[model samples]
Target: MNTLPKPAMRPARPEFSSGPCAKRPGWNPENLSNAVLGRSHRSKIGKARLKEAIDRTREVLGVPDDYLVGIVPGSDTGAVEMALWSMLGPRPVQLLAFESFGKDWVTDVTKQLKLDAEVLDAPYGKLPDLTKVRKDADLVFTWNGTTSGVRVPNADFIAADREGVTICDATSAAFAQDLDWAKLDVVTFSWQKALGGEAAHGVLVLSPRAVARLESYTPAWPMPKLFRMTKGGKVTLDLFEGATINTPSMLAVEDAVDALKWAASIGGFTEMKRRADANLAVLEAWVAKTPWVAFLAEDAATRSNTSVCLKVVDPRIAGLSADAQADFAKKLASVLEKEGVALDVGGYRDAPPGLRIWCGATVETSDLDALTPWLDWAFASTLDALQAA
Candidate 1:
């Protein structure tokens, strides 16, 4: 039996998954025991820390004064759903989709919210045609699709002055990429992505426009207890200021605090951006030398720095059945996994056949370099396996 050679490259630590990514801040996990976790979140101390996390996050991310932060329930999904269910009635709704999370939003808009939505979509490897979207429509979009490794490079296409609101699901994009605040009316993210915090909480940042819409426009459906954000038919300022309707884990708040504190210590957003860019550079160099490899997303500018998707280009395997392609990718992923070269390199369940290596902010560039040669060997051995079959 032939085997891939062991790679000499080694990260300062092991890495490669998208979320629950390798811990960068390097806070002592043992410190969790000393943290105040089991206490009720409504207590003064709990709310204070949670408030600190929200405020510090704003400072680190440089959110504008007009945008208010809400510690909402659910991870990124919950925050996004709340925005969709609460804010999409007065204007025409446009759903921009390119990947799994974007597809989820499409389902929510058309199926769950049951709104009359015009879908501006591209396949897994492409970007939605933003040029054709009705600029005045209330738009819901995923800034970065973690599954497909595609992200919108710029927000210039979004009209500066429009009647509609732009609600963005920025879960993976929050700390990993720079956001154009002027183009977005609402942005939501979870602590679990680039921050490496607990998963139960989501951070919802609402621009003045979103708040205005909430006050002036109401959805045609019942406001469930979880989704309710209004009181007296007005957008409550309290919700944006440490008055979360639901209880949150205080420890999670501390973890978020630690993550944000970590971000600040590492020279803020610029440093995080640098790390991500450098890591992607490592992947790009690796992808260049491999003849059977190419980006799933065609354009370099549109391709995500956080999650990089790669496709196998061997002509013999290219025309194989879908199952065969999947099997081959899985075999390669498994090979890397066993060798400790990578873990969780498989494509998301909804995406096409390929390896999706996450190169988020928290992930160090050295790890990406370490994982590449291992990939080269894994695919080579897998091809040999396929030929034997």
Candidate 2:
């Protein structure tokens, strides 16, 4: 019997799950000490804190002056649903779905909303042909697919003179990528992703066009209070001013403010994007040298800088059955977990059998650098364990 030699370096923080990603480098429990807990969210101080969250988000993201940003219920999902249910039925919808979250939106529009929709879907690692998308139809898509690690390279495919609105789910892309605000009418994200804030609340940004669509159109179906953003055929401007549609957690609100302040302290979006890019570069360098791993996204342009998904390319592992490959990937993750080198690096449950590493802004590149050798060690260790069995 031989003992596997453990890697010398370890990540200072091992909280790498994609959604509730690693918190900002210096985050501490004390950051939430000023939270207005045990108080009414509608109160003056609470509302001010919520408004600060919205205002800081706008300032950090460089959102245009006329664009309205609001805090909504249900995190990113809530914000997206609110937009879809409110404004989708007015025009023909074209949904581009390449991953699980995008596919979920397709299901929502086609099944739940029952709108006149054209769903353009592709397999896990690929994107739908953007050139083929109808220019006149309302567009809905994820800017970055967390599960697939495929991100739309840019907004060039969208027509500049298109008649309808473009709704974007940018939960994982917001701070990590450049968003063409002129091309997107609606953008939604949660605090949990790139900002590394607490979840439960979603940030919804609306262009003038999106506001017009909401005020002009009414859905045939009933809009739950949770999904309601309009009142009496008018977009509620109060929502943008920190008047939430429902009760919100002031504690979460304060945590979000802390995260946003951290973002601003570090040079805002450019710094965030740079950090994510560097983190992904760490994996890209390793993958380029290691023949065993390949990016799940076939095209380099479409590969995500946030959730970096990788597939096993080594013939010894790739030759196995799909279930066996899945098991192998799980074993690789378990080995790293047991060694306390990494956590939650497994592929999404519904995604292809592989590993998904989060490279969001909140993660330190040095941590990723330390984790890389551990990944190689874990893979080799797993292979040995399999052979011994």
Candidate 3:
């Protein structure tokens, strides 16, 4: 048996799944000490904490003053579903699906909602034809395809004066990418993503247009309390000011506040994005030199800086059957996990056989640099071990 020498450096924090990503650099359980755990969310103190979370999120993200930000039930999925169910029937819809999440949304619109939806789909590592999208129709798309590691390079595809609203599921892109608020009508994300806060809640942002749609046009389907943003045929403005439609965990709210404050302290969105970019740079450099691996996203311009997916390019691994390739990828990830160098680096089950490394802002660049060498070691070891077996 050939024994591979272990790498000297390891990431201090090895919690790198895309959702519930690595927490802020110095996060500890005690950070939630001030949570109003045993009180009503509508109570004055609890409301204040919730409002603080909303206010800080708006400020840090530079959301336009006209836009309304609300804390909604469910995580990113909940927020996205709420928008899709409430706002799609009034107009024709154009849906883009390049990854699993986007594909899920497509199913929701085409099968569930049963709306007049034109779905534009791409393969695992590519983008759909944006040119075919109709400006007159409502557009639904993911800002970043977490599963495929592909992202829309810019919002240029969205017209400045479209007739319908643009609903965006930006769960993975929220903090790391620059959102064009003027070009978007509905944007949704969860606290568990780029900000690295606790989950069970989602943040939904609505443009004035989105609000108008809710208030003026009611959906044909019955709107549950969970997805209801309007009351008595009017937009419930209180939801934007800390009045949640459902009970939320005060502990999670406090953690979100902590994450927002940490974001502001580190120079806000720009600094957070810079940190993620740096992490990606470290991995990109390594990928350029490594012959055995290549980015899953074929276009460099569309590659994601956060959910960085890489495919096994070595002939030995890449040439294996699909099931074998998937198994091999799993074994490689397990090798790193057992070595304590990385964790949760496996590709999404529905995605192509590859490794998905979360390079979100909370992840330290030094850790990524340390982990890269370990990746090389793990690959060599996995190949050697598999051949022997």
Candidate 4:
């Protein structure tokens, strides 16, 4: 068997794991030295820092002034659950689920919340029919399918004058994609994603319409204290002002502020989206030339710029049994990891046998450029080993 030589170049920092993704270029732990620590989160200083995180988030992300942005616990999951538990019972619900996380929300709505939602589902690589989404029903979906690497092309399908609230889990899409804020009633994301900050905290942005729903309607089930956004049938204005329901990691808040400041310094959301798009272009060019692999997203329009997923299309790999195919893909990822050229580039366990790479805003485009050659090398080496054995 012919041996493939390792690539000469490597990604400068290979900490790509999708969630908890690559940090901002030139990031250092020293940046968080001024983090408000060893103090009560309710203290004036702590609240000031938390409010700074929220203000900077709105500034960088171009969130409208009327919207309420709050720091929530449990990362993106908590934010989504809170929205599901607090505001969904009043309206007929429709769920669009194309990938793992989206399906999880479907489960939350159907089994946990016990809401009789109409679930519109598609296989991992495709999107549910947007035309079928009802204007009268509350809609739940992830703006980007993180595991499958399929993202909604745009918000055109959502009716501008619709009566329903559109709840979007946009953890992967928040900084990396252009969110149509006017179309989304409830938008949730985590700092651990695009900003590459610490986890365990979520940012929830509520449109005025959503806040109205929170005030007007109460869920049929018990609302956990952490999920409660209202008090005395009024939207808790303090939460949006940085008074958190639970004690938060001040260190994480500091990390997020650092990241947000970095993002603003580098030209904010436009530049962030550009960086992600450029990274995706790097992978797209490589996939175009490399016959062995193809994107998992069936439509180029739906291809994610953040979590880019790919599948081995070579007959030798594709022809294998399901388990064998998965093994080969894992072996390919393992080879890359062992070489230290890439890290955590394996496909999601529930996703098809392939590769899932983080191309979020924090990832350096040059790193992706450097990493592609290593990917080719790993594939060649792994394929050679497979044929020999």
Candidate 5:
């Protein structure tokens, strides 16, 4: 056999990115192609599967008996927009911002709907000042910022009985971390993120307060068919059962059900938390002694286990500039992905220049650990290339 050289190392799977994250090992897309395809979403079999997905979601999330789960279109974005549009006009809003998605909601609330609110904002790497939340204001916050890779430590900051409701975009935090249902009014997420489910739908969970808002107050404008949570001026419990707001991809529902079932078989939230903890340990170890690397979050307790962001620390490397750092990370991700070692490591475009790695529950810690050294190699390669050029 003729050999030129041996490869340094081969990764077991792609490195994790936050959303549209690395798929579960041995996930065959064709497995879904063979799923209950071409069935009417309202058919008996289809309804059973949809209901099962919702039930499993409720079970795994430990959702309170007073809450309801609805399957809706447009993934997490839709779930969140529906909540914002329906629930905002009646209350003074406290919109919190720490990262890009939060900023997006701010734009929607301020510039788009032109709503009145108190904004509790912070820079990317820090937590929002929760102490300033108006007790009389409805609050909007993301439990985790997948962009900046920072998260609120807990919901303990909220009052036990604030008059205004809390609407949370917990897309990245749901299932991977513990969520206190008592403190939440409307919580929304997409299956595509941590659950490794397909796109096209969102899971919207609402507390009794949110439902009561529906029963009491109507939006000042005509509600779209997709945004209308009520039917004939009454809350439609069937939407929480099996009737989705719009037509859903049966295949996606099956895929989501499979992911939920997998979560259940491995022991619901405990297994998810275990996987997330293991991944975070790997990330923490990697960030500790890498010479030029440090966590973006200043505080360890508030650092996100799901979306971990790292910044280059060596003063010598600071000369490269933040934009350069961002470009370098994108190059690193591209190179690794081309070699099949990793995929999607660059920070979100709207975030500060840094590398963001996902440590969500569905990702294998062994795969994450195996990819860390490759990051060093990637950085060194970048430095050498820049010097040579």
Candidate 6:
């Protein structure tokens, strides 16, 4: 039987869920005191606050001056859907899918929209072949696969000069990775991922090319009022200037601004990337020494620093049936949660049986460092219980 002792030191803050991740360090409810509550979003004060969110986003991410940044409803999912429904019918489409969210986009293109899109896919822990991509076809892909813990290493595969536009879902990669903005036409993300802001709101960034597509092409199907971005063959400039299509929760807007301010105060995206990288390094070190666990990402270059997934490599666990392995992983996660060292660390439902830990910028490296020992204890204790059973 395994005889590992329980860990004495626990993480000071353990809000490690991948989505709606931990808030910025030293965050307080008082930070949102400036929110303009009980006012229409179209009012002066409300519009100014919304505009601040867009401006701060561009400043921190180094977005191009020509690109238009806007706040859209429905988190990252909403932003992507709007883009697909608005601009995809103009040309041939190609999609790269390696994870659950990526697969969802493929479904939207094929099943929902009924577009004849060419799909390139890979199993979990790997990326689709970028060489197979065609420059003539409009491309849709995720910069980082949050569920599978994989990400495209860079934007080198995208053609520098191509007829097609590229749409990127960068929800998890926005604040934590370097994005090659010049190569991308449309990019979408959420405030809740790396910045740890409030959820249900998405940020959509469109290049001049993307705006041109919006102004030129109209989908054959009916466009929902919420998805409309153009009027009389012209892109809606008001949306980019913070005139939202629907009423927004001012409290959530306030929380987003607070998070952006925190990001800027700490030297902006560079510092955020450094913190996330350091947090990932902690897990890398642990996995290198731990005999049982391995990263779900097959290649080091493709591994994600934010949603770091891990699989059990020990023969005892790997030898079990698929359902049994999933149950074991659940038991391991429960042990950590019961001990209060980690919460919501289980792998995504559609992903392989394993563990997924959030290592976003808002998560402290010290907390990750503290949590590794607890992970070891949980694994050992779970294994012991299984052997006894």
Q: Which is the leading candidate under lDDT? A: 6
Q: Please give, for residues 1-389, the per-residue lDDT of candidate 3 as tens digits.
A: 43558877788887778888889999999998999989999999989999999999999999999999999999999999999989999889999999999999999999999887899999989999999878899999999999999999999999898999999999999999989999999999999999999898999999999999998898888888899888899889999999999999999999999999999999999999999899989989999999999999989899999999999999988889999999999999999889888888999999999899999999999899889889989998999989998
TM-scores vs. true structure, each candidate: 0.96, 0.98, 0.99, 0.99, 0.95, 0.99
Better of 2 and 6 by lDDT: 6
Q: Is candidate 1 or candidate 2 better by lDDT?
A: 2
Compose the digit string of candidate 1's lDDT tens values, residues 1-389: 55667667755565677776666646677645545577767677777777788899998899998899999999999999899999998889999889989888899889977888999989988888889767789889999888888889989879988889999999888887989998999999999888877888888999999888888877788888888888888877777777787888777777788888889999888888888889889988888887888899888988888888888887877889999998888898898888777888888878998888878778877677777777878888888888888
For candidate 4, the per-residue lDDT at 161 reads 91
Error in Å for residue 381 of model 5: 0.3
Candidates ranked, most accurate by TM-score first: 6, 4, 3, 2, 1, 5
Candidate 1 weakest ten by summed lDDT: 30-39
Estimate every model's Cα lDDT from 0 to 1. 0.84, 0.91, 0.93, 0.93, 0.83, 0.95
| Segments in model 1 whose C-alpha atoms lie over 4 Å from true places | 1-4
| Candidate 5 local distance difference test against the native | 0.83
Stretches of model 4 off by over 4 angstroms after superposition: none
**lDDT by residue (tens digit), candidate 5, 169-250:** 9999998888888999999999988898888799999998998888888887767888888877678999998988788998
> Which is the winner by lDDT between candidate 2 and candidate 3?
3
lDDT: worst 10-residue window of model 4 = 1-10
TM-score of 2: 0.98
Task: Tell me how many clashing residue pairs each candidate has.
Answer: 1, 0, 0, 0, 0, 0
Candidate 3 lDDT for residue 103: 97
Q: After superposition, how far is residue 261 of candidate 5 from its true place, in Å?
A: 0.9
**10 residues in a row with least lDDT, candidate 3:** 1-10
